[model samples]
Target: MKKSTKMMFFTMMIIGTMITMSSNSWMSMWMGLEVNMMSFIPLIYKMKNNKSAESSMIYFLTQSMSSMLMLFSISMNSMMENKMMILLTISLMIKMGAAPFQMWFTEMMNKMSWMNCLILMTWQKMAPMFICQMSQEKFLMSSALSTMVGAIGGLNQTSTRKIMAFSSINHMGWMMMCTTFNNNLWIMYLLIYSTLMMPLAWMFNEKMIMHSSQMMTNMKSMTEKMNITCMMMSMGGMPPMLGFLPKWMAINSMMESNMYMIMIMMIMMSIITLFYYMRITMSTMMIYEVQKKWMMINQNKNMYTSIMLTMNLLLMTMMMFF
Candidate 1:
């Protein structure tokens, strides 16, 4: 796509998300979702990649069906009806790519470029999750199940993108749990999650990486390896890392709310997610390299990589006072 055209679609996409988030009615939210989808599909395509085009189609169809369901539920004469609420919740879960409703999400992510993948993983989630509402039981069930599914789904996968897709699902579960307590908590979780993801995604995109094996053989610099390792560990929500802070806060909130059952489930699945994260970084840690910098792509190491990595640790430090 041309620069101007891309910019236009991107702006519209942002506006669409804002519309949905700010809308006071379900009908308006549904309209915003449609606008967002229309704009995003264009951005997901490349000049000649038929796979990307196919991915866009899948994304469109899935989102369209979900939106249709959402509209139908909203059009019901009484919004308070139990059946309408259930249908609305299901549609939102489908749109958010929560567990048992995320097959399209995984398929779409596999064929997308890194930038598109980042948008799908982070930005695209905002509108649906922003408006998500349901009973505590539904929230708890979605949270526990998504966390477990995400953790198990990534274990046997070698594709880096697929792993990240699963990781997003895992974090989606956490954010869902966050909703059970307070909206601000999930917003905090989302911000922290996005912070950890950006640099890792950048590194992968720059290196043209698609598998864990690439991290071992492709990233030759020690700095590269260290950065990637720490980021992955943090992403896994391990202690003393930035990612752990949000999960920690979430668990604390759940504890205060007496949500012990789902809390334990999330913690166990988190450990499973950490295992795959370890698998990805273990080889890099084992290998010794003498290169003095991060990847030297375009003949210059992007200073922002380390800057973002440091930002993570700095955030982790805030956990000490809490």
Candidate 2:
């Protein structure tokens, strides 16, 4: 892709975000979403690989369907003298790839490059989540169920991208829970998540591939191993890292709200999540010189530096709170 084209695409995504923020009507929100989708299609194609193309197709179709459903729900609400929170909530849940509709997320992650996966994981999430929060009273059940499903589903993913996909879904549950609390918490969670995740994606993107097995023997130095450990721990929501902060805040907030049932459910699921995270962390940290020879490609230094630096800083930041 040309420099001009990249600039143009980003310009449109920003415009779409602006439009969605300014508008109360669903029509304007739909337009903004289309703009965002259109902008990203180019980034997906920039890789020029078949997998990228395939992932792009799936993402576009799924997003289009969700946008259409949102429009239809809004129209229906207009006619019914009031909004049907259930329909709107379901649409938002589908868009966010929450429970009962999370297949698309896992599938897309399986097919995309690491960098593309990162973009999908982070940037693509805000709009749908915002829309869902807007109608909190209408979709609380779906949100609650999505939280449970996301936590459980992430427990067994083998692929790195699939793991992150489920992690995003899991975190979505936490983010949704925050909606019931206060706007300050919601914004804080978003900020902290974005701060931590951008580097995680960058770290993985340095590798280009999405399988933990592929990374088993790639790093030769002790420094690289430690950096990877930090990232994996951050994702696991372990103490002394930024990731742990959100989960802790969320649990405390839930308990404070007297939502004991959901709180206990989240705690159990979180323990399950530790297993998946540990699998990756173990691979990255302990597989330095395993017996079997594994085929690997040239390491990308630029990608590695960015991920390492950003993640270490995030880890350090989290440790300060301890």
Candidate 3:
């Protein structure tokens, strides 16, 4: 965990993702993915912790299996068999941790540092997802299953990281759907997803919050509570929020394609996800006190936190004028 070592791995991550994004050949793409996987495993290891070690090992096994399958599928592409293409799609799905292939994802999140979790949730997905996009295979069934599984899986979880992991899986479904239809929409969804997630991740890291209950107990001021509530609500894709914009566009696209059933299912599952966010928000609101002692004691006024929260909360309103 030396500073130099971290930088080296970080550089590898950037290079790997760039290579995958730019590569025209499947072999080069697979090489970039291997580089990404190898670089990330070291970053997952925390000092003197068996859990991180175990998590990293599991991650390596899963990713390596998927990489091999990808290579095999590529090798067999000349046969023009449907089964080979299906295997390729499944390999990318596993690499991206889409649901049904998502068993490793939450466990890995639980053991990783918040920084590593951020990278896992966001940057690590880029290469495989881009591969998925390019494959152009029909995976609507997988997309629906991912969204449904993500929604139901998080409903009973108290752990914040696990919930976010499920949320990521759910978003992956939407991303897959968009990628299947329009590349531009997929990119827009990703940008917005990352934008909403950054503030939430930063807040959790700053407060060391690991559960929904912690938010209710740890926040001291009305402002902190409100900010947290607003942020979570927006992230849940409530109407008039920045997060809703992408979903709105997605629904419109789905409708145009006559995908009514899939559209309905996605909307319903999203409502279930929002219900949990509201539950957490309500818990915090009900416990908030107006007493002087509760007035902004040791408020986190970190510049980055303030800026991200402000942008997340107000960006939708700003967009209204244009």
Candidate 4:
């Protein structure tokens, strides 16, 4: 694609998200989602390979079906408000790829470029999830199901992208739970989730890492390995890391709301997710028998990694003080 074309599509995505965020009416929100889908489809299609084309087609079909359902529900809500609300909720759930609706999400992650995966996992979630928050619907069953599916689905995956996709679903569950009690907490969770995800995505793109098996073979130095391990652990929301803060806050809020059963289920599922993360971390640290390859580390990349690690540590300490 041409530079100008890419720029245009990127701008459209941003504008579309802004429209969704600012829109008070369901009609405008739905329109914004359509704009986002249209802009993003081109970005997903690649001339070099048919995989991107296939992924884009799947994405388009899914979004179109969801949009149709949403439109129908909106039109019919006057006749049966409660039933229409449930239909509308399901439509948004499908759009966001919350569990049971998540098969397309994992497939797309496997086929997409790292940049596209990042957008799918993070930016693409904002509109639908925000809509879910605004709807104030009871999504307890969906939230729990998504959490369990994300945790269990990722346990056997070797693909790094698929693992992250499941992780995103798990976080979506947490975000959904947050929406039940407070919108402000949902915003905070999203912010922290995106912040922690950006560095990991950047690392994956920089290294061209696609699988968990490659970590032990590809990483050069102990420092690099350690940084990646810590980052992954942090992303898993391990205690004493910056990632833990949001989950901690979320659990606290849930407890205050007398949501004990759901809170317990979420914590258990999170532990399962963290177990896989630990497996990845241990693989990086323990299996270091590959022929040593002296790959020159880029200074800027090193600086960025250092800054991120330092900030995480600093924040962890600051939280401890409070």
lDDT of 2 at 317: 67
What TM-score quantifies how close candidate 4 is to the native fold? Answer: 0.95
Clashing pairs in 1: none
Estimate, for each residue in 271-291, the C-alpha lDDT of model 3 and write its tens digit: 888888888889889986645
Instruction: Write down the lDDT of every candidate, Cα atoms only.
Output: 0.85, 0.72, 0.84, 0.87
Candidate 1's C-alpha runs over 4 A off are: 77-80, 133-137, 290-305
Cα lDDT tens digits, model 4, 1-322, are: 9989999998999899989999998999999999999999999994558889899999999999999999999889779999889989989999999988999999999999888999998899899988888888978999999999999999999999999999999999998888888468888888878878887888788778999988887676666677788778877889788788889998998889899998999999999999999998897899654554565554555666775767577676759775
- Which of the two candidates, 1 or 2, achieves a greater lDDT against the reference? 1
lDDT, model 1: 0.85
lDDT of 1 by residue, 1-322 (tens): 7899999999999999999888888788889999999999999985449989899999989998999888888888385678777888888899989998989888888899888999999899888778773233247788888999899999999999999999999999999888877457888888888888888898899889998888877786666777788889989988888899999999989899888887898899999999999988997789876355463453324564556557765875786667
Candidate 2 local Cα displacement, residue 108, angstroms? 0.8
Model 2 misplacement above 4 A: 81-83, 289-322
Top candidate (lDDT): 4
Q: In model 3, what are the clashing residue pairs, if there are any?
A: none
Candidate 3: where are CA atoms >4 Å away?
290-299, 302-305, 312-314
- Can you write out model 2's per-residue Cα lDDT over 1-322, one digit (the tens) per residue? 8989988987887777677766797788878878888888888888788988888898889888887777888788757734555667767777778777889888988887776777677777777766665664534465567666766776666777888888777777777788777455666677777766776676667645467776665565445666677766766677766677878888888888788987788767666666677877776676565443464333654556676777667667656754
Residue clash pairs of candidate 4: none
Each prediction's total of clashing residue pairs, residues at least 3 apart in sequence or on different chains, is 0, 0, 0, 0
Worst 10 residues of 1 by lDDT: 292-301
